[model samples]
Each structure stands twice: as structure tokens, then as C-alpha cells.
Target: MNAPANQIPLQSATVGSDDEIDLFELIAVVWNGRRVLLGLMVTAVTLAAIYVGLTPKLYNASADIYPVNTIQLALISPGFSADAENRATGELSPELLFNTALMKLHSENMAEQFLSTTGAQVNPQGANPQTAKQFLDALSVSKEKSGTRAAINLHGTQPQETATQLKAYLNFVSQAVIVSVSRDLLAALDASIQYIDRSMEQARQQAENKRLDKAAVLAEAADIAAALSIQEPRIDHLAHTEVTPFNDKLYLLGTRALQAELAALQSRKQKDAFIPELRQLEAAKSALLMDAEKVRQHQTSIDAFTLPASILAPTQPAAPKTALILIAAVVIGLIAGLVTVFVRQGIRAYKIRTQSAYMAGYKKEILRREGHYAVL
Candidate 1:
């Protein structure tokens, strides 16, 4: 092995020569199958082009809704205060209102409502359950990561129509919130009004009962004065006979005054005037009624939340990306072309190797037979 230093250089040269020859053979294989490779590539590109062309185009439209700004908050604050007495109606804070609208935007009930209302024109098949479900699925409502805003997105064949529908859906959600809150507010006001009415009625009844009791006391005193034959004030014996309060002894006013007071009390018609709390109760009731009226009058104008920006229809189609599809086609075509070339070359090489081995075996057998015949 140590005597082969010169042969090592020769062996290395032979290895280099074999590697060069293999590289050239590979190049030859590719060159000879150029037609097949080119055909496959062209076919792949053509099919991709056809598929891209036939696909329908779609456009996306999105609208953003943010929490109510201070201006809108100020506008609706007075209305919310009207229901302060009944917390069961819930507070309509800006965050709660915004969340409510966002919830309604994604709710199935809203989908059905839109389908029956504005969606009818877009989808004339009417709001069957299936249709409503499909419409709901088409809608996308997502809150931004910052949590300050939410977005509603939709895609369709017509950009303008899609944008219009999205805007209408937003309006529908806003209106739904307004209607729900207004209804609760009105109900609370109505309950307050009823409660005030009951209180006023109770006050009037108590006042009337007190008036009747006073009249009875006056009647008894007048009878006692008439029996004693006293027609005028009798302060002469008041201090001497264990003097009590005047109210405890109405007879001291004499029969004439007592009779007059009794007649007046029996003839009183406006008992409410005697009820001290009646005026305050009436004022409160009037205030509640006014609030309810104001709510009704301005319910339609109330904006629960604000739109931060306008929803614009995208001018470009979102689907059927032309450049991307063409580039993908080229890449796929190139890959298919190379694969086809290698596969064909490999099959041809395998066939040639098989034939060469068979031919060598047959020639060896013929030589053996000729040698056998010569020996014979």
C-alpha cells in the first residue's frame, strides 16, 4: 500500500473524469427531453390561467364603529338620567351601548331582522331560516386589539352594494339599541308615574279621614256647648278647672263657633288642598311625565354610538389575484416540466441497462456453446 504514491494521483484524476462525464450525461438527458419538459410546463401554465380567469371576483367592504364620543354622550346623558330611579333598566353607559351594538351586529336576531328589512332587496328570496343563517355567516364583526373600536366586514360581487348593505346593517344595529333602551326608559317612567299616583291617592285618603275625624270632634263639642247654653267663648273658668289645650276642649269656643266650624268642615270639597305633600307629589309626577314625553319625541334622534369613519367600498377585487396566480402558475409549470423530464430520462436509462445486460448474457452463452463444440 505504501508503494502507490504515484498511482494515487492517477486514481484521483480518474475519479474527477468520471464525475465530469456523469455531469455531462445529466445535461444531455435534460437537453434530449426538452420538448416534453416544455410541453408539460406550457400545459400547466395554460390550465392555471384558465382556472384564474374563470373564478368569480369578490370585493370586500368594511366599516368601523367606535365608542360614543363625548358629544354623543352629552346628547344622551339626560335621557339616561330619566331612569335613575329604576336601576333594573340597566345603565346605558358608552361602553355598554357600544358593546350592545356590537353584539347586535353579530346576533342572529339582527341577521333575521336585516334579512326581512334591508336585506330583502339584496336577497329577494326572503328571510327563511337558511337564508338568514347564510346572511349571518357572510357578516364578520371583530373588535380591534386595542379594544377601542370594532369592525364589520363583508364581501360580495358588487362593491357598492356590499358597502351599502354594511352601512344599512350598522344603522339597523344602532336603531335596535335605541329602541331597546327607549322602551326600558319609558317603562321605568311609567312605573314611577304609577307609583307617584298611588302615593298621591293615599295622601288624599288620609287627609280626608283626618278631616272627618275633626268634624266628628267638632260636632260633639257643639252638642255639649248647646246643652250648657254657652254661645260664646268661656275663658272665665278655663284657668280654674284644670286648664287643658284648646283642642282638648273645643267647647270653650262656644256652640256658635263650633257649629260654624263643623258646617265648614262638612262642606269642604277640595280635600287635596289640605294634604301638605300633595303639591310636591304633583310636581314630581309632572316632571316624570315631561321626561317621558321628551324621550318619545327624541327617541328616533338618539345615537347610541358613533361611527369613527366612513365605510368605503374597495375599488379593487379582493379575489382572483391575477399576478399571484400567474406567478404560481409559472412556478408550478417549471416544477412539472423538470419532473416530467427526469421521469422520462430515468425510464429510458433503465430500459437501456436492461437490454445491455440481456445482450451480454446471450453473448456469453454463445461463446460457451462454441467452446463446447470445439472440445467435442
Candidate 2:
């Protein structure tokens, strides 16, 4: 059956009244637990303040670095130039050099090396895994949006100390880059020198072999001349003619001349003078040796990178933010207190409903027994 319109409106009004009463009860419960809420908030704020006081303050120091110019690149790598062809070799590009520095800065090996060499109070044995990780965690290298510069940031307890350490670390990385380049240059020069030496040696061997062959040919010719009893000059006109030196007619030279030429060739000790290309190889080897020396000498004078700005130490601590921590603590405490109040109210309501239901059931059983007695 359909209910009347007035009846439906009355039922809706009754439901709205119950909801309003419940809302008031909830408010009352929260107000009665105000002391508990205040106590919780105070405890949380106190703890947060204590933590702020106990934690050590950390300051940040940062510096910017950019790629060195072409002149500096030349200083680092001998024969390097600003030409596109040279840059195409990959080893001579300024961008590649700067990226290499960035890679080293982010490497764990570099962190360990810095810890071990700088005497930063690491383990006595050396830079252990934990120490190296901590050092890396405290340091950061980030490139700028323009991609032309990179920033190095470090955290430490003291501002001055942090700035000084950052500067020292930069210097160390620069020296390492320079040394690596110098070592590579020397290795290349040494390789070239070795190649030249091998070529010279091979040329000398070939020349000596040719000399032996020539001597054999001369001895055979001398024997032939002696059998023929020729004194000299069967080929006296052959030298003036366009005939090749190895022509068979040259064998007609007199026995005395052939024997004298063979003896002179056999007595020669040095074959390098006969190798036409050996002098050019010697010159190249000497040039390589000189370049290696120049690289060594320039190692101390060259700069591997350039700093765009000085390292600036921060005056304020980067961590242990007191105000933000305290505000967060207050917010958490209020939330916890509200939750606790609602939970307590819910438990009380459940217990009261349970007791009322149990008492009503007991009374119903008594009434049933009394009615049974009357019926009997």
C-alpha cells in the first residue's frame, strides 16, 4: 500500500531530528575529551623540539664549473685543436672532457679516493664501504639547464669546512684529469716511437739482406771473369749506357774489379746508412720523444677545467627544519586526539546498548514464567 503524502513528510522530519541529535552528541564527546587532546599535543610538540635540539645542523656548499676553452684543451691534450675534424676524434672535444669530469665526480671510486687521500677521519684500514657511501650521499653533481655548466654541492657540519673541502675536492679532480690526459699522451708517443723503431729495424734488415745478395753476385762475376782471363772494362761503357745495374753484361767486368767491390761490401759494418727511409724514421722518433717530454713538463702548468664562480658556504642549516617539524607534529597530534575521542565514545555506546538488551531479555523471561503460573 502507498503511504499518504503527509505521513512520508512526518517520517522524514523524524529522521532529520535523530541526525541532529547524533551530531550534538559527537560534539559533546569531543569537548569532554579536551584534556586528553591537549596533553597529546603538548607531548608531541615537546618531542619534536627535543629532536630539533639534538640533531646536528648541516650546511651546504656549492660551486659551479664549466668546460675549459680550446687553449686549455690543448694544454691538457697535446695536438688538440678547435677544428671540427679533431673534435670528431671524441678525445679532443671540450664537452667530452667536461662530461668526463662530471662522471668522475659522481663515481664511488672517486669518493673513496677522496676519503682516503684527504684524511677525512675514515677507518684506519682505508675508505670502507660505509664511509664511501656516506661521502657520496653527502655530495651531489647536477648540470645546469643550459648544459654548459655543472654545479657541485656538498653538505657538512661547518660552513667554512664544507666550502674548503669542496674546493679541495674540485682541485683534486682537476689534477686527476690532467694526469690522466698526460699519461695518455705519453702512451701514444711511446707507441709511435715503438712503431718507428720497428720500421727502422726492418729496413736495416732488408738492406743487409740486399748487401749479402749483391756480394754473392759480385763473387760469381769475379769467378767468371777469372775463367775468361779478362783484366778489366768489359762493362766500362756499360756505366755510361742506360743499362740497368743488374744487367748480365755487368758480369763481364774484370776479375780484379769484381773481387775488390765484393771485399769492400763485405767489410762494411753499418747497414742503416744504406737504408734510405731510416733517417726519416729516426726523425719521427725523435719528434715523438720531444712531445712526450713536453707533455710531462706541461702537466704541472695546465688547468683541466674552469670554475665559473667561487664556492659559497650557506649560513643557514640545510636540515633539521624546526618550524616545519613543529607544525607537522601539531597537526599529527590533533588528528590522533580526535581519533582517540571518537573511539572511546563508540566503545561506551556499544557497552550501554549491550547491557540494555541483556536486562530486557531477563525481564521478558520473568514475565513469561509469571503468566505460566497464573495459567496453571
For TM-score, the strongest prediction is 1
Determine which window of 10 residues in candidate 2 has minimal summed lDDT.
Answer: 81-90
Task: Give a tens-digit lDDT track for model 1, residues 1-376.
Answer: 4666566443555556743547778788889888877887788778888988887677788877788765565433444332223323234577878887888887888788777776455731122333666667667888988768887788776787778777777887888898887788788778878878888988888998888888888888888889888898777856565522236576877889989888989999888888888987887778777777876877788666786346787899877888898788878887887888888887887899899999999999999999999999
Give per-model TM-scores. Answer: 0.77, 0.71
Residue-pair clash count for candidate 1: 0
Candidate 2 lDDT by residue in tens digits, 1-376: 8887777444655666644556777779989999888888888898999999988887888898988888766654544211211221125557776877888887888777887787664322223433777767788899987878888888877787778778877887877877876787677667666767777878888898899888888887778778888767655555566533365655566778888889999999776788788887777667566667777877878556786356777899888888899999999889888998888877998899899999999999999999999999
Model 2 TM? 0.71
Candidate 2 Cα lDDT to native: 0.75
Candidate 1 RMSD computed on C-alpha atoms after optimal superposition onto the true structure: 6.0
